[model samples]
Target chain A: MSSLDLRNLKINVGGKPIVKDFSLTVPKGEVHALMGPNGSGKSTLAKALAGHEDYEIVGGEAFLNGQNILEMETDEISRAGLFMAFQYPSEIPGVSIANFIRAALTARLAENEELDAAQYYRRLYEKMDLLKIDRKFTARSVNEGFSGGEKKRCEILQMAMLQPQIAIMDETDSGLDIDALRIVSEGVNTMRGPNLGILLITHYQRLLEYIVPDRVHVMWDGRIVRSGGKNLALELEEKGYDWVKEEVAAV
Target chain B: MPATIEKETSSESIAIDRDIGNFKYKEDYSYDAGTGLSEKTVEYISNVKNEEEWVRDFRLKALKIFESKPTPTHWASKDLENIDYSKIRYYLSKGQQPSRTWDEVPDDVKETFERLGIPEQERKFLAGVEAQFDSEAAYSNMKTKLAEEGVIFVGSTEGLKEHPEIFRKFFGKVIPTGDNKFSALNSAVFSGGSFIYVPPGVHVKQPLQAYFRINAENFGQFERTLIIADEGSEVTYMEGCTAPKFETTTLHSAVVELVAMKGARIQYITVQNWSENVFNLVTKRGMAMEDATIKWIDCNIGSRLTMKYPGVILKGRGARGEVLSIALANDGQHQDTGAKMIHAANDTTSNIIAKSISVGTGRSSYRGLVQMPKHLKNCKNNTECDALLINTNSRTDTYPAINVRGDGNSVQHEASVSKVSAEQIFYMQQRGLSEAQAMSLAVNGFVNDLIREFPMEYSVELKRLIDLQMEGSVG
Candidate 1:
């Protein structure tokens, strides 16, 4: 029952429907891959689930661990254990990465409670060592001038520190090379456990080769038209996306 | 002077949005100049203080200059016309000389400084402290060790009375009365600011601080501060000001003069947080001699209109000047501030870095000047001004005039204006921060480089004040 369940979610951008009649359920202890071509409403679904103001959820019920998320504020939804790794992260010029992560974690604390700096740095250093990030990065501004690979790795580092129950990684492999992709996937795999549920949204099948998914769902025209096991990803990679469009049309 | 005009009770106290530095206690003043400015008013103040004959003549002369000069409106904001000189009480005092110990201060005055946490700060880090209420300092104290080392840290009144030789020589020398209209006005009716002088080769280990509090409505607080660092001496001086929120407008005008002798250095820092109904106009300038350095670190927030541009005149060979400033303008506020550096000597150098933030309908302007005359050789100047606008309605402007002549002199100027994009706010919000927190974080980040230049104690307090100003700024 610990899962993210979406029922008939409809989203609009600037009053134009972009996500129509979408439904998915990714239970805990599982990794689900949502793959589609460009402009297939994959990103829309991710943004709408994160409660972005621009992505209006006209009608839907998004429950995270049986609590409705649609009615909550953006930050409230985040504190409710839902993490969204952005495709293009913002550059906060003067905020160091260490401070940013500390603020995020501090937000999760109860009133009259303070964060322990020693323990926090210890865990942060451990995670950084695992991800191959230098210790000096803690002092640098967050994503101010980071390379694409470094930006993706920072996202994973944030995810590791936050320890969210559910995560939605949108195009995590868009601008990464083979080495960067491998490093990012390794960081993600370290957090994969029975307590975490991941919704990996990517267009290419190459990312699935690193962190294999339990299920593959093909989204077309705003809704999922095909669902199968992990091999469905390789099959779709072998057959072009046009084949899925034709198959959906014929059906 | 006319009979002491009773205070008109504010129909309703302006709702203060923040809990910090917004409370005021009832006023029971022993001397009030009764809501006007005239020769009689000036004479009344001089007579009450029993000032020297020369000082009294100086005040009369400055008063004539103040009346002759017109309000500066050629290029400044139109808000200058709103100040009615006849309606403002020129001075108010509790009539007690500045106490050397907090126990001797009146209860209400003591409670005011206690709430502002001034005495706590004095004990923790400051070597000397001065607390000014209205037109006179309620408490002024310096460590015995510093006073034993031939350092003089006292209120201006005592300095002028006891050490006339040094005080009179440099009182209005750095900033002459005719320098500007506000300077002339301040020279006529100034009171309650600090006077510090360090002997040759004596460096005060800790900073000396002054706190100015305006407790009454419809009053003008004109404080004149003068600091002279003797040859090879070093000192750091800091000041802070705040007033309560009221429906009517209040005025605060001050003139600060600094003199850094040969090989000496002086750092002057200020953080003023007047209520939104107060108009703060100040003139601060320093003179650096051969091989000397002068630096000004200023931050302005929580005022209706603030026009302060601290300047330094490099008058000797190899002198240096620097100004690092941060300003935040909230709704219905205008922060017009910048710096000025005049290189009158060979091989002089100056640097200016200013950052401002405009929230809601607030507007911030940076007007700077850097001049190197033809006679100066190998002089260098660098100026940078950056502005951040929070809402679409927020505004910012920059006006930098650089006049560099001669073959070896060089000048560099750069400016930028940016807005907090929706994406940046949303990005921080997704990390579990409220909209207001996110906005404050971004603003703090924008001024992070400059804030680091402040003293450690003040940097923390500055960040907290910024957070309070940003509480209701965002949706």
Candidate 2:
């Protein structure tokens, strides 16, 4: 019965407001899609929710499972069951993907508790296989010199491993081809269950074809102006975002 | 938990100079052999060790040269100028002879070595252990199998007395006393260091180790070591050093000379963690004959100032040399370490990779030289030096010299200096690691390539050391 509630959240970057008065509620077993054109504050909202240091919350309140998350450190926020998949993942050279994920998992365990190596590897290999990643990917450095598609797959792999309560994917389909997008979508679909809430941010309706979101919200000018069922994504895709801007201007 | 708490409580009262008496050799050795460049002090040392006339004259000549030469002014730190040579004790050794068994060693010296993890490593896997307390080796032992195979492992003093033929042949040929001011000083009053000799065609599978402990104040420890690998023989040597902290500075000027004969291989590894009050200046060099190989793996962790450059001379055809070095400089420490490679013959190759990290106002510098002679055709050399500054107050410098005279020689040099950026820390923090933990991971990642070259146990200890350095790096 986990949920994330964002109440009238406002976010700014570089002294300019990006997300203004944004509100969203994602309960367990629900998948929400944030649809917008470029520069529509969708990524800013995701980053703000993840407690990124650069995205200053000018006025906002974010909660994870009834616990206020804005006051926690970024790492604490992450350990509190919030995970963000970056549009451009960082390349940590010489740090193996296995070690990095193991460290994150290790941080979550009780101080005196130890992880079973065999079971851990077993789970890791299963996740990698589900993502279609090669077994050798475990030894490779995290996102270092990886292709765009490979980076996205790695992000999904991490989400599968950490199994956070709320997973925010920021433009997860950007630079991904049809094959990669389908694979990444399938991996996410496999992890969707009663205890997980997902917020997928994307610029186009193409990703929606595979993920099949339960709810769609159109963000325009730092605010979610429209919210509806999945039909909203197809309607918005048929007509360009200019139509929405024109309608808003007429109002 | 009780042991850990006891250790913590004991560490609180452990001043830098509290363990001076742990240097048992200082207690029994008479300090009357004062710091004088006279024939008498040399004669006293020679008489005390019962050395032959040739060895005694060698010391006298070295002493004369040491007195005439002035300390170098251009290289190294100016703090070395304050070393009061007149006030330093030359040599100090316990009255007992070098023991082959750990039980025969004095209790104080044995306890110091035990605390340093020497006995544990020896009992577990070491092929031999030579523990030097103060100025002389208190205990020296090698596996009986190695002795039966004609592998000579003993103190330099014992080697001079027993195997003078082999000792006299290659004593100062690689690193002469005139090579540096510190080398000259070491030549004059050098006491106890390991002397290893591997017979022709015999390969020693395990690594021999030497542990040096300096436990007395104002006492200079000058240990000279020599290793000769005969034709087709292979051997590896490891050395670790630690000294008690003292209010007054102590001088440690050691000289190590190695010779690898035709088709032989020699590897030398040194891990030194001296206290902040000690000046560690060492000169180590090796000569590689036809088709021979030599490697120097060095890690410098703690010292007020350290100036050490392990050099290799490729004197025969198809010879090869390599140096892998890592230095970590904490507060008030200066690690000036690098390598030197000289290609004197055709078809020789050499490589140098040096990595250093500086934290908390510490400074580390890489000064390297690679030279290929004009007549040496088909020679190749690659030099890479990188430094990582962990804090705003820390600094790093690189000074590399590459000389290639022949057209057929290929020489490449690359150097870079980078500091840990705030964005990197933020990015790592976003992945669920604390600021301090992020800093440690980044630093470890920075040196991961070089660290993988170390043994598994040493790599683990190095990571722990890096973690300790990163503990207070962040608020």
* TM per candidate: 0.97, 0.91
**Candidate 1 residues A107-225, lDDT tens each?**
89996799999999999999999999999998989899999999999999999999989999999999999999999999999899998999999999999999999999999988998
Q: What is the interface RMSD of each candidate, in Å?
A: 0.6, 1.4
What DockQ, between 0 and 1, does each candidate earn? 0.87, 0.54
lDDT by residue (tens digit), candidate 1, B121-197 = 99999999999999999999999999999999999988999899999999999999988888999999988799999
Q: DockQ for model 2? A: 0.54
How good is the docking of model 1, by CAPRI class? high
lDDT of 2 by residue, B1-475 (tens): 0112122224433521233222222344553476644677778778888888887888888888888887775766888898888777777777537888888887767776767778899888789999998888988999999999999999999998889899999999999888988898888888999899999999898889998988767888989999999999999999988886677888899999999999999999888878788899999999999999999999898889999999999999999999999998888889999999999999999999999989888999999999987877999999999898888999898888888897999988888887877666666666788888887887888789988987766787677767756765566
The alpha-carbon deviation from the true structure for residue A196 of candidate 2, after best TM-score superposition, in angstroms, is 2.4
Clashing pairs in 2: none
Q: What TM-score does each model's chain B reach against the true chain B? A: 0.96, 0.93
lDDT of 1 at A195: 87
* Per-residue lDDT of B396 in model 2: 92
